[model samples]
Target chain A: MNRRCSLITILATAAALFTGCEREEIRVYSVAKETAEAPAKAASDTPTPAANAPRPQLAYTLPAGWQDAGPTPMSLANFRITTDAGEASVNITPLASMAGKEALVVNMWREQVGQKPLAEGELAGALAPIEIGGEKGQLFEIAGSRDGQTVRIITAFLHRGGASWFYKLQGADAVLTAQKPVFVEFLKTVRIKEPGSAPAAEVVKVADPAPAATAEFKWKVPEGWQTLPAGQMQVAKFAVPARDGAKAEVFVSVFPSDTGGALANVNRWRRQLGLEAVDEAGLKALVTPLEGAPGAMLVDLKSDAKAMLGAIVPREGRWWFYKLMGDTAAVTAERAAFIRFVQTAP
Target chain B: MKLLWKFFTSLRLTVWTLGFAIALVFLGTLAQVHEGLWDGQTRWFRSYFVLRKAGDVWWVPPVFPGGYFIGAVLLLNLLAAHLKRFQLTWRKAGINLTHFGILLMLVGGLATDMYSRESVMNLREGGTRFFSEATREHELVFIRTLDDAREEVVAIPTALLRTGAEVRDAKLPFPVKVKSYWVNSTPDFRAPMGKNAAPLSDKGIAKDWDFSERPETKGMDDRNLPTAILDLGEHGVWVVPSWASDELLIESVKRTYTKSVGAETAAGMAAKMAAPQEVEAGGRKWRMTLRPTRHYNSFSLTLLKTTHEIYLGTSTSTNPQGIPKNFQSRVRINNPTKGETREVDIYMNNPLRYEGLTFFQATMGRDEIVDVGRSGLQVVRNPSWLVPYLSCLLVGIGLTVQFLYHLIGFITKRRATVAV
Candidate 1:
């Protein structure tokens, strides 16, 4: 069991960590203070740029055959924007569907980052998006190094009415790390469209289970004993008639089959009481009720194993048992009366 | 003088100290009903506090028995009494063994305090490790030098610096101050943030104050508290943000007028306006960055992989989540001193210790868009932590032996009765 438990834990961890194979923080720490976007080039070394680079051209090549997935999200939708050394991407997820900055969102990110949730006084950063790659997107930036690296995440959100998209980019600020451009390229593929405007996914319907055709009826039994119908969790009951307002109840789990039936049952009851515990052979040698009116057998036993006796009736497959147990003297006096009651349990 | 031993080792003293210790813990637990170990806990208990108003105000963690303090006292008493009483017994060997165990525990605690490098090692999937870093323990302090009084005078509210702004605290004579801070400061990098109010440059200070005046304190960036914005020219802008202005804080040439926590304008789901900001004094500050420390060179670690485990078949309605198991972050360690780099695996409860520092696996996070992983670790540098481990082992062994002795005695008595 312990091994199985550990196996499950290992599987769960693997499933969680393997989501996106081994993620690492890429950070480049420099003493220089300015966020100074590295000079667009090593040269023009002297030539100062004219106000802005000619209409901000896309410096990196787009992946071949990469088509737009959707359009920018509608305004008022929660969005995120990420800017890296290369390009940038944006994602928008509808606040309505996601339940708006819910606890799950943080948890999901925590998992992605291979971290637990933020401890108290640890979540220190900014909200709202700044423009990345000339496109406006929500930007969530955290400026603290965790472990031994500085991790900054900028999330841009774009929300349409019912749905939303989010673009998240995080990594160590490295002068040279692989994630920088990959993140930017990842953002380029994201686009949103009108819901349902796209072809609807095929829907499959499943048939519902047939309802139970249950019927209710009333029956009178020995005074102080109650008869529960078949539909109730309690199938049938036969009480040892009330004496001075105090009664002991015997419950029965009834079935309709008799194969490997009643003979197997009487001994099962005796075995349960742990009072010398008889076997089917011993049961045959003892009690007298089996000339085939559904094979009945009875043996005197203690009340301590009552639950076990009640359990046996459910067994015997379809063979129902009219088992009764109570204060010995009380039961002995009422035995014949209870036996007649079981015959009508239906 | 003999009475002194009675005083220190007196039963009355022991009982009083013991009772007080026990009471202290209970009261501390109760006080936690009002205040807790952290401001978040304190804030969490705030509304539910059925206690008095002054409860939180005068809150201090209870100094009860730990494996160290009370353990020491108990051991000292045991040692003295045993030496005097059992010195004549042939069972002195047994008693010696017991006392040795206890002494070991006390010595162990001291060793732990001095030498033990107990730290947490948290690693997700693929995380790196550095040899000189240990996982465990943290400090809350602002870096600063002593003031004119020759005493450690790093005053707060000044300890609270606004983002992109330096913290300014005042001293009666000459104010001692430290600049630059971060809320969730890491081993590297700090993001700049400030209040919604105007920059401190608009309020006071010299216009030419030059420095990366951001994140100079723990959670000290962008004035979340309210304040009189000091527009000190180049000194940058500073606004005492937050709702409350406990007092006018003047440190050095920087003067920031702060108020109490005022409004709730966060994203509603925000826990509260802010955490509890206390007016503290005498707190020490040492730069504890993952970068090049005052002595050690800046080394880097790479995340190999971070793996996690969870308890099975149970969700929120069923079972509580289990601890992360086998948190192994394979790290490539680089030593600037030796000019050598080594790769080692770091996991929970296990760390890579070298030089004076130790590193433990702490936590892990992912960068989905960035395509990478991040792992947190606790770094420590205590020199003598093993003594406690040895002492504890001895003590535990002695206790087990003693308990079994009595247990066997009982069993023999029962057997004798049956035979009779």
Candidate 2:
């Protein structure tokens, strides 16, 4: 009896072990609630013309005798200039960044004009510095033959509002030469508006209820501040009255944690103020600790005309943006108030 | 016990199982021409019993013997042979080690086959992603944008969606009823007053274009563009894969409308006012679309840039016959929970392994349009990935020791013969 029992027990244990090593169970994942958010739209997906749409008045004015041909997919503004010799076309394109070296762009134009690309040493002689919209820019003029007709292209490159703008006028040599002076006058009329001024459509009063108690932090609003309806991509908006009757705005927004991180957000704010982008080390120099909120950072950036006081607070897998931006004097006056509001959050 | 031992340790059984496995692999490779790699793998290599479809009909009687059966028999034979014949003698030690290594490799393969998951992460330049999506399967996603910058997403796997199937979940505010579903389809457009023309849905961007189901394609590069007509009661919308973006659909609608009206109006202005496919329920707005099912990770990867180098003297991309010199992705891995941030370059043959997941640079292409670089990384997770390495080491060591032992014995015998 003992021998039989031992044999049966050994077989049972072996069988059990083999069965225990069966295939892994198919995983059934439940929905994860209140986690990190979806990513923001890609930088490339942000249309260049739409980026300038919020400040349409900042665009260049059409020269006299130039008919507006409207915007194209790649160009923000398109116009047709009619002359006795022939008709010329003008395209104003604003891009998020310079995609390549200046030489590559010049070569691309040369190729379009049916002319050979200039060598490295020849590039210096081909480009000349010119002033457009109160900013120094590069100008290039190339003449070539296309379809047995003399064609000319006059191109200008300008940097403004943290973006690269290209203005090109291409047509018959006679027409392009005649329209060159008018194009220069058109470039001078370009206006880059100060950041933080509300778009004309958004200047109307919009009633927005205060935030609910679902948030972990609460704050007390200062006097003479009116809450406006929070638009898309914004959590809250507050209008602060200025002595000159123009209002400086304080707004709150939030994004997924590390959604471009602190440096990218700071550079985006600087871009809004028409300032140059900074490197990581420069970002650190611009950031300071918020007085009461541990692990929170405050960034103060200013251009010649506009300034921004912003705070970035990381919490619960989300990053919050609290900013007050407007005229230099207005932003400076509200800097302490913005800091106090952020510090008083509980 | 003796009878069981004899059956398990039989050399005939091992030979039979192995031979059947070889035949099955041969037949599976031939089947891949008709069925794609994914379907062929699931039907042949992954299943316990291989079902032979009758005349291309799936719902027919099946024939016998699959990969799982052969593998199981082989495993049993190996274990039983070891138990019956294994001894601790020095002469048999090498054989024992070799057999053990082989057994480990078989088990490891089984584990990997059962548990491994593969997905792809696609990123545009300067884009970041926290999840990877399965290349073969798709899901219908309902996204609700919350005020706190977070999104509440309810995903339904494509396998569960069929014609006339009602999908209801506690997490969803409203039940979605699928009216029609097609694995592959093409949009059929006609004049508004054409014969046999179907009415358009009031919601989706392609409201004017009718849909016609097409047979699933078997070409290697062809992808199944699934489309479905779903009813949310008061609203109805059409759902297609991510390749069919809202803008593309709106453009198609505008083109078809212009053709019908025989006018060349500015379609761009009309496209701007196109209504998006959105549904309102439970005091919130939800955007519904069909996308690949995503596998979220705790960490996030940001693609700093992707570079694709071509061969010299070629204006186009690298020649199809010749490999590119270099295709690389510079990515930054950030794990806030662990407080770790590092930049790693992933390129051909060199993969980044982190948290048991291996990321391989799979392909490089443009991001929807030319001039924007996009990188595709293949992410694989297999808990048994280390098994093959260990098995190879053990097998090599055992074979070396066995060879040396025989060589020494031969030398001793030769010397003794010379003395004699």
Candidate 3:
């Protein structure tokens, strides 16, 4: 009996230990929130420039035969010169605090043109000295082959006011060579001015020009709705007065393309109301055709406390999004009016 | 029963187990060339069987007894042998001590393997962290900010996350249903999305980007970027990827609104916008992220400074930037329970061991543009770290006692002969 009891105890203990070896369960815990801390003062001996220093403006004369290509994502000012040989482009870009990494910057341009990167020791030997805006700078002329054709690049960079400005002209060898002298003369005409200075004619301002709306659609404003100025990316805006301390707004926005499709747009509206997103099939089930508008679908999403009423209308190669978002009660009150308002012609 | 006892207590079992151990080590080392150290160790040493995939299929069969099997056998063999031959005598004391020491070591090894934890803490200068994250494993976390200083977090381990798995907890307002789980995925920002693009998550950053599945990374320096499409019944489907940078994504969205509203209002509305990896339900905001599994601690470490130094004027042909000679982190430890707030410096060789954990300086990097320095510390917790030392001491004492006893007996016998 004793031996049998001992065996049973051993097996039971073994089973208990094995059972305890299962994977950990889901855990819930409260932790102190992470608060951002200010970075410690830099220990370097040299004074580091502040990132948000006062802005400076650059004014330059546009060379003849060169047309302003407008601003690009990579450059603040862009100009193009077209000839029989090929088109050459000039770009002026400003970067903050490139003080000690000049060689790194030059190497990046070299790599762009299929040229080998130069070491910091070899940088000075490869670059020639030039003057830009009365300030000394380095000019790099690199010629490399791309797609069995010779490509030439002429770039000059200067450091001033804790910012590095690069003026680069690149194109087919023949075109770039022809425009090189003109680019150099244009660089000499560049001048940096402090902010709040009087503007010169043809001087490009340093600001992102908001895209002009291609087309406008008239909407029948409901009673008790207040008119407000449209914000960026919005064509028109209307505010609904606060009811029970809850405010709602209607925004009419247009995008160049289908902004990630109708499903994405409906989900974006749904997400605003703390509601779960639905798939394409689910979206179709929830979408209702606008009464007077053809090929337009309206979505109404409501959560416990919040709601959003939106419409996706496609017209004239653009997508129009109409959204009315606010407290659930307010949205519920305006659901019919919101749908009727979206049914207006584009 | 008698035959079983004989077999377990036999010396032949010991020899065979040791031979298998040597073979296991050899195979594991060779596997590391392709499988990496961590994975190889897990496959060969941490398991009981060496499993082989049955010809490119999911079926894996045990082909050989692995390290754990051999170790357990050897342990049982030693224990049984000691039990069978146990005798309390001065003459046999040394042998018994030596056997017990080896037994203790084997048990300690198993303990360490089962209980040890390795994690990492990354902190920028003046940043404080109360938890260390697992080096490789990931967890899905839903964090609700209760206030400016406190947050309620519910974390689900990735092991429990599988396709078609619905995870529910009392603390969760809704069930987290996983639609698809990718162990490794790469995001493409420029991929054109047509009407027929794969149906990804309906919300979050994944809607703006396309993700492609990739093979799991096995390199020592590489990590798998996991992505999961999760559905919360009525709340919405969200794509949570490990590679999403919440700060950068939120800042970009805030910048768009800041152009219209003032900077202050935009900053306040950052969480209000459809921020990536964020969801809202029950009038509460929850930020979801698939990140390295975190191990919270009772105390916190605040990074005060990071010092990186290199030998002056020393540059090699391969390294234009001089090789780092030293990396140090100055950290302040805060333990509210003990009312202890003290600063300590951890460097390459010197580590800070406190509260059953050891913090070693692992890596340091600096962002020259932002002038922010970050430090990574390897946190290791092993309760049996001193077991090897204690075992070695016992073995030394046992062998010394054995050798001295024989020497004394031999000398005394010789002296007796000389006197006679």
Q: Quick one: best TM-score, which candidate?
A: 3
Encode model 1's per-residue lDDT on B1-420: one tens digit a residue. 456445444666557656755754565455544343433222222222233334344554322333234434554555445534445443344446666876676555444444444443333234322323221112122233354323232223322333344433343222222233333221100111110122224321211111222332212112222223333333333322222111111110111101110111111101111112222334532211111111123565555655555555443654455544455667776666678788787777788776656777766655321345556666676665665566667667667766776777799999999999
Candidate 3, superposed: residue stretches over 4 Å from native: A1-22, A40-346, B54-62, B190-199, B245-274
Number of the candidate with higher DockQ, 2 or 3: 3
What's the true lDDT of residue B371 in model 1? Answer: 41
User: Candidate 1 residues A1-346, lDDT tens each?
Assistant: 2434433443453343224222222222222111211211111122212211121111222221122233211111112222234322222322324434423444445544455766434443434544433455444443444445445555554443443344554444541133434445444443443434554322111112111113232434666566543222124555566554434567654433332455555555666565565566866565655322354544445555242222232223344555566555556556666655544434
TM-score per candidate for chain A alone: 0.31, 0.41, 0.42
What are the per-model DockQ values? 0.00, 0.01, 0.13
Q: Distance from true position, residue B296, model 3, in Å?
A: 1.4
Model 3, B1-420: lDDT tens digits are 657667777899999999889988888778777678887788888887887864322423347677777877787778777767778887888888888889889878877887889999988887788999887888999999888889999999988889999999988888999988889887643111011144476576654555667988877788887888889989888888776533434456446644433344344344332234677788898889888899999999999989989998777778866888999999999999899999999999899999999999998997432467889999999999999889888888888888888999999999999999
Give the winner by lDDT. Answer: 3
Candidate 2's C-alpha runs over 4 A off are A1-346, B1-5, B56-62, B188-196, B231-276, B314-323, B413-420
For candidate 1, the per-residue lDDT at A112 reads 40
Model 1 chain A poorest ten-residue lDDT run: A204-213
User: Per-residue alpha-carbon lDDT of model 2 for A1-346, expressed as tens digits?
Assistant: 2434444544664564345444311123433343321233422233333333543334554444466776643355667766566788887765444534678778866775578998999999998988788788889988876546666778888766556678888876777866787788777766555457654232111122123212334678877778786543466778886857545889887655444578878998999988899999999899999876778999988888778899998766566789998887877777777888777653
Question: Which has the higher lDDT value, candidate number 1 or candidate number 2?
Answer: 2
